[model samples]
Target: MTDAMTLDSYLAAGGVLTNPTNVPPRYRAELMKLMATFVDSELAGAAGFADVINQGPGIKERIAAAKIVLEKTDHADRVLKIMGEFGADTDRYATHHPWTARLDRKADIGATRSEHDMRLAVFNYPISGWTDAVVMNLLMSRAVAEQLAEFSTVSYQPLAEAFRQIAPIEAHHGELALEGAVKLVENGASQDMQDAVDYWWPRVAVSFGRDDPNRFEHLRSLGLRHSTNAALRERWARSADEALKQLGLKSPS
Candidate 1:
């Protein structure tokens, strides 16, 4: 059989590619893009959160925010190492863009990426303060959970394993956000929390990206994607809505 056919059959049968040398050109391109998106998002996320660490209400809250910032940067490094194997300039990649830069909070960019990097559009909005940061973190972390779950099973063995290890750490970040939100609600910040949620919900929702069946199927054939964007977004919406309801906050209509 041809090498392409062999690779196709292998991927179709749930095989995993362990290294960059064996990856086909098209698959390599797609995989690099995937890794770049993940790394860029993590770096930007960490940078953004770092600014809010001092704004956390208490020592514990500040510590949690600091840990998130540290771990997110580490996560970006982990994936960037994988990209490095594919000839990406790991050093230059992390430093070339302004990771801490953000658009005005009221700007509406939808899911479109910024010109300089592949970080998700949601990361382009600034956190208003402690409460707003917590709301954005909680909502966005849930989205990250969904995305990580999908990524953990990718056909690239090394990248998939990296995601598997990173998933629990990211989930812990979500738990911290949940704890912070609950405390804020108990401390009479329920309305503020709701307003932040209203502001962040649609922005976070758009991070799941648009629903395109053809693109999804193409990724699926390469074992780079498993679920449709709409399905993943709907799942995140249900979970996020329930989380808000627990804090006595309603999702924006």
Candidate 2:
């Protein structure tokens, strides 16, 4: 904020950089990676869900599913435009990979990513059916909410502002998923719903990634991250468990 402030000191003192030109080279690289990861995950998530709109049990369910697909893709676009400010080939980046492509349902790749994209590891697995899709959406939405909460506070003003505007919309997607799950339970799929929860919990948990203190410190110095991965994962666990309990569904072991 002061005229003589260095970027590091400014960020450490809670200053925000409003433009791409204001960012240093290393900060720019990390910010690009962060944006790319989010964009890839959103595109992949939307693509996976696009296939399930017809699998919805009713018109309302189908409408919710379609809206989610639309909004998530929109969210990706908003961030990708930011990436474009850094000279990334936005057109090529969008079409560079098959976003809809997924691994076999039984793939056990853990948090390892496929060769071509940076979508979270959890997205690599295919959605099995309506129930499975609902569960994945609900759980992943909570994780996304936590991530957005953190991202919304980073030192990059424009990207942080983008996430701030995005957090509420993403939260609504989680709410829609929760509502859909409750409908499934009321319609006599409670047990089946629990099974879906069990299937997705671990995969979603791993998407939080492993904690590396060194890496966290490095990123923190750049003002790109405030909390460690372990902390965020634990926070999401509690949030997910509480959400599951309200629906009378037990959290996975």
Candidate 3:
């Protein structure tokens, strides 16, 4: 069998590629794109959240926000290091894009990425205020948890190991958001929290993007993706809805 066929067969049999040298050209391209998207999103997310750290309502909140910012930057660094093994210029890549740049709150970009970065479209919209920032964090962190769960099983062993280590930290970020939301609700910010939820629900929902069966099938065959976008989106929606309900809020109507 050809090298590509042998690689495909091995991946199909649940084999893992441990290093860049073992990655085929096509797999390398897709893997690089995946890693770029993740690193870009994390960097953009950290930059945006950093702006709101001072807006947090209390010292604890600020600390939590700061922790998130620091850890997310670390996560990006981890993935970018893996990309560097593929000859990516890690230094230039991190600074090449204006990670903090965002569109107007009213911009309707859907799931499309911005021209200069691969961040999810949800991050492109500005966080409105303290309440809005908390709400956005709660929602988006859940989405991140779902995506990380899927990626933790990727065919690239090193990347998968990085994700495995990062998953719990990301999940803890979600827990912090939940604590913040509960506190906000108890402080009579229910209406404000709900408004933020309504505003962010659809935007965060679209970050899962649309399902493309053909593309999904191809990625699945390569051990790059294990679930359809729609399935992951639904999982996120269910978890998000439950989180809102716990806060005595509802998903956008």
Candidate 4:
């Protein structure tokens, strides 16, 4: 009921910040880190998927894959513009890394970031083929949807609004992936698709991040995060599991 509140109190009370000028130093740093991770992940994911577009089983599948690649790059550009407001050299930042470069598919670098960028670790692994790529797309898209939903409630209004606009597009990508997956299953690739699911499930889950209460406490205090990583991961797992079940695929152990 208080008409006037401190920045901390305002944010804690679900208030929003509309611009970069007034953010606190630590909040700005944290926000930049968060945005960087998103931008880098989208860029890396798009780049990785670009090569696999040709591997899609049919014209429609190829089109879906291609569309996902385009939109993910666009999503990165959208968030990178916000990072630019924080004085980032967006031009250099986008091309600074070899976004197309990825580690071996069997690399065991769990939740670790590459030296060159802040993309989630799941993206560092290479995609094997059409089924593998589609499975990765389906699982990771759901993870992205969950993360974007959490981010849409971020205290930064501009970024929150951007995420809100983006959530459905990202959700649509998941729908496309789901549809492709169903077709793959129908085409007698169910076992191969299940194998791909098993490979990507754990990696995608790790993208939700560690269940660090201390870190979540700091982020939550700033209203940068509205939910715990564990909670978000659980939500994603439940949804992803049901989706997989409907497709006659088993959830990864």
**Residues 1-253 of candidate 2: C-alpha lDDT, one tens digit per residue:** 7533477787777778888877888889899989989999999999999999999999999999999999999999999999999998888887899998998887888899868888999889899899989989989999999999899998888899999999999999999999998898889888888988888999999998998889898788778899888889999999999989988998867
Q: Which stretches of candidate 3 lie over 4 Å from their true place?
A: none
Could you tell me every candidate's TM-score relative to the true structure? 0.98, 0.96, 0.98, 0.96
Q: In candidate 4, which residue pairs get closer than 3 Å at backbone N, Cα or C atoms, i.e. clash?
A: none
State the TM-score for model 1.
0.98
Pick by lDDT: 1 or 4, better one: 1
Task: Enumerate residue pairs that collide in model 1.
Answer: none
Q: For residues 1-253, write the lDDT of model 3, one tens digit per residue.
A: 9988887888877788998877889899999989999999999999999999999988999999999999999999999999999999997987899999999888998899999988889889988888999999999999998999999999999999999999999999999999999999999999999989988999999998998889888788789999888888999999999999999999987
- Give me the runs in candidate 2 sitting further than 4 Å from their true place: 1-5
Error of 1 at 161 (Å): 0.3
Tell me how far the alpha carbon of residue 124 in candidate 4 is from the true structure, in angstroms, after superposition: 0.1
Worst 10 residues of 4 by lDDT: 1-10
* lDDT of model 2, residue 129: 90
Superposed by TM-score, candidate 2 places the C-alpha of residue 249 at a distance from the truth, in angstroms, of: 1.3
Which run of 10 residues does model 1 get worst, by summed lDDT? 5-14
Better of 3 and 4 by TM-score: 3
Displacement of residue 4 (Cα, Å) in model 1 is 1.2
